[model samples]
Target chain A: MTWQPELDELRAREAEARKLGGADKIARQHAGGRLTVRERIEGVVDPGSFHEVGAIAGQAEYAPDGTLKRLTPSNCVMGRAQVDGRPVVVVGDDFTVRGGSADATIREKPIMAERMAHDLRLPIIRIIEGSGGGGSVKTIETTGRANLPGGVGGTQLYHYTGANLSVVPVVGLGLGSVAGLGAARLAASHYSVMTKETSAMFVAGPPVVKRLGEDLTKQELGGWEIQTKAGAVDHAVESEAEAFDCARRFLSYLPASVHALPPVTTPTDDPARREEKLFTHIPRDRRRVYQMRPIINAVVDQGSFFEMGRMFGRSIITGLARLNGKPVALMASDPFFYGGSWTADACAKIIRFVDLAETFHLPVVYLQDCPGFMVGLAAEKAATIRLGVRAMAAVNQTTVPWCTMIIRNAFGVAGVVHQPANRYSPRYAWLSARWGSLPLEGGIEAAYAADMAEAEDPAAKLAEIEERLNRLRSPFRTAEAFWVEEIIDPRDTRRLLCEFADLAWPLLTPAPSGLRMRP
Target chain B: MAESPITIRAEIGASVWKILATPGAAVGEEEPILILESMKMEIPVVAPHDGVVVEILVAEGQQVEEGQAVATFRR
Candidate 1:
């Protein structure tokens, strides 16, 4: 191919367009421990594959003397690219120019990116930083009037987030201070991530909060720790690279958009491979706590568990794991915290995780060791019952294949709720299943009061009652009644779950028509 | 012959306020090892049996009924 003059001219134009803020601004952005908007897009997409849209479209200013005053285009960038060869549309906020304020959000920038993704059936990754299309104070000054709510280009951002929940996978990366509409953008995505040191998300920054008479640092208001632990953001990473990597990993388990099924990879582990360690993972002493993470790792693929909302619900762990190379939603009770008692916060987390799994057509794998719901004045005040019922309802409504393994301590009504309803109940198994109305320690004293009082030594009499009840509470008693399907050895969990994965694989061939929106 | 032990029903029916001992907090027979509050009054939950506290069923601020075992001791 010969180098034509028009082709060379166009190349120069593209280079000029990229140098929007000049070299000084670009270097300053690098010096401040931040990536330029274009650099971030490059970091997320496969190298040299991004085909940018609307590069030449920007604002043109004229002076009173009929000469050019300044040239400023849209303070946002939009393009199409591939992540690991999977096509996706990307939108980034150019913060170096006008702080990416809403006034500079050109009409076609958001619409082009959103509509293209929607029409082309591709996932959209939005690299949002700064105000991210929110109206700034200077905008009102420049326009000589306040922009009406939902006015021109007002609902564009809303439509972008709304489409993600319904038709496509939207991932938001919080790389800087995300406030107002920016924070909403971060939350509205299916998966969101933030850099621990550099990113913060809040309804309003410290300036607005300070004016309201409360002094707070930006980190105190909405740092990565606060957001991730509060369930505002799904994951937090130590670096921007890790945040991007997290987003890529999350999308791997989900479809490019809502209309497709998640891609399946070949299984590397044998379906019948069993790890004997699970048999003794739970301690014989009920009061002692054991680490639940290892049990989760042992059951899933050797190194395939990717946890979400980990810190928020300390009592429950939710994540994505591959069983025989098939993606499954993994939920487990963390016995270390509050004795694995589900609290109001933990209930909310369960509901959210279940909804996501059901909507995405992912089968659920529950490693249950729940003692039941947390009870107290604090629980009641927090409306634990209402939240608990909602969690139960979410689990009940899910149509996906579910498999529950009772590791230990399935007691009380909350424990019963872990199993699905009788008709569409999941394939249930018990590994040392121990179920009852309550633990015997508390029940023995009340039931045997008369017998204890009549004995010569009341204290000694109570001990005899406890000893008898302990014998009755054994898992062998429950197994004799056939209450649980089978009491397999702990090491058999991996093999059993892999078998369930094979059984459930036939169900994933067809996409469900009515995909529930994640709650 | 043994005298009948008094049945100590909770004066305030509520969840556990706080469990003061593990399975083995040395407690005098009449000493309060746990506290339960219901309505508005702070109800002192006392040791029903004297010995080494063998098992504490509930943790701090756990819910308990009028006659729930907050702890068990070997006399």
Candidate 2:
């Protein structure tokens, strides 16, 4: 009569179901080095936080005597759990049950999970494994029918998740072989991760790919390394634990849904705390390359930069850095890389980075040293202009505080786009700013081409023109004309930037905007 | 037979941008040697070591490249 008896019976049923198809089948799963659905859930979520929605519901099988041999619930686990004390809905596909084919996938579980997330407005974490509800050969035999080309269930889930994406942050953890719908689900997330050892996501597996005359391993076909580097997945972690940690960190910067603003954490550093090193961070010699990291480190709160897409955009550095403990998006030109030239990749990276900052209400601090967009035939072929314009659009569209510091080379359209509108521009600063059409080295020949051609002493005339242009090209001239703000010493950069941060902090008003489109 | 020592040299004379390899780290012949920054230009020091990097003679920010002995390793 006690409720404990019902719980005991349910536990017994699950154990008996696990023994379905005998000990040999269970051993095979063990040999593959995979944990069961329950085990995976336990590994990912906080310990003892999982509360299952459907435990005893599974597939129905029969014996030769025409009697029910076993009652196996759906091959997926759905539940609510607390990750870092924040409520989250979790779903994991159980590969042991018919490889998680669409035939055995119960309609109720996924719908229930999706609805729960939508109604409660909690983050939905889908632990995708197996083929993600694709119709199997056995499905036709079992149903005595074939699934229609576009099934209602698959369509419904797609639309539902797509709509929810703009409303809430959806995270996907690809923990095993994922194909078709599973791959799409992973792609739909704001942030996604795949395990290095056992997880992969592709349209089809190796066997299907081999039929089309291509041989590839599961890892090569859809490995985490390949996907993450290509930006198909945001992260590739060594283990499930690492993937879980990434999800937690990602969610820390976002609210439960678009309706709510991101929660702000108190800063550990004083708003006025300034480092003196920034003054001398940029070298006096234009030919010498100085480290930009030190300059960024000195300006931001100590140990607050969390870089994103560090490898993809070498010329432009993008990361989250705190000023007076308030999170701000830090984007700077690494002059060491192609003279801080905006390449196609760097442009695309900036577009996405700025979009994320705007979406999450993070103010942007641009430490400008941009020389210009990469030139030449190769740059044009790479669609550098198209991408560069988009990067500019993202920066301009952002309502968040947009502070800019012209630390060095600021030339051409690439340099001009660094600052927002003069009125809304986040308190602008110029430290020995080099502003012009381009650097003197490349333009000197063009500017004096006629003079050199006319002069009997061509070399001497060229030198004379270069010397005159260099004098006029100095930042002091620009400051005198008021083309730029005050031109301060490199050593005063930290204090100036800290002051800028203070001025911009009061202007940062939280917005309830949803995730913006990534370029 | 023992492999010959691979000598790492700078391609240009500028400040060191970054050191991607450390002593005893395995590197491919085509991998980034050392990143050099000159005139705000990043020139990679390609791996001379088809084996482990035996030593790193230069620290980051040290100006050296173009024939400067940055590191030597047994191939």
Which sections of candidate 1 miss by over 4 Å?
A1-13, A62-71, A425-430, A443-462, A509-515, B1-75
lDDT, candidate 1, at B31 = 71
Total clashes, candidate 2?
A: 15
Local lDDT at A155 for model 1: 81
lDDT of each: 0.76, 0.73
lDDT (10s digit) by residue, model 1, range A251-329: 7887776567777788887777777777677667565556789989887887889998887767799989899888999
> Each predicted complex: what DockQ?
0.03, 0.19
TM-score of each: 0.82, 0.79
Provide the fnat value for model 2, as a fraction from 0 to 1.
0.22
Candidate 2 ranges with C-alpha deviation above 4 Å: A1-36, A62-71, A100-103, A136-150, A211-213, A285-291, A335-337, A430-432, A445-449, A455-463, A488-511, A514-519, B1-40, B46-75
Top DockQ hit:
2
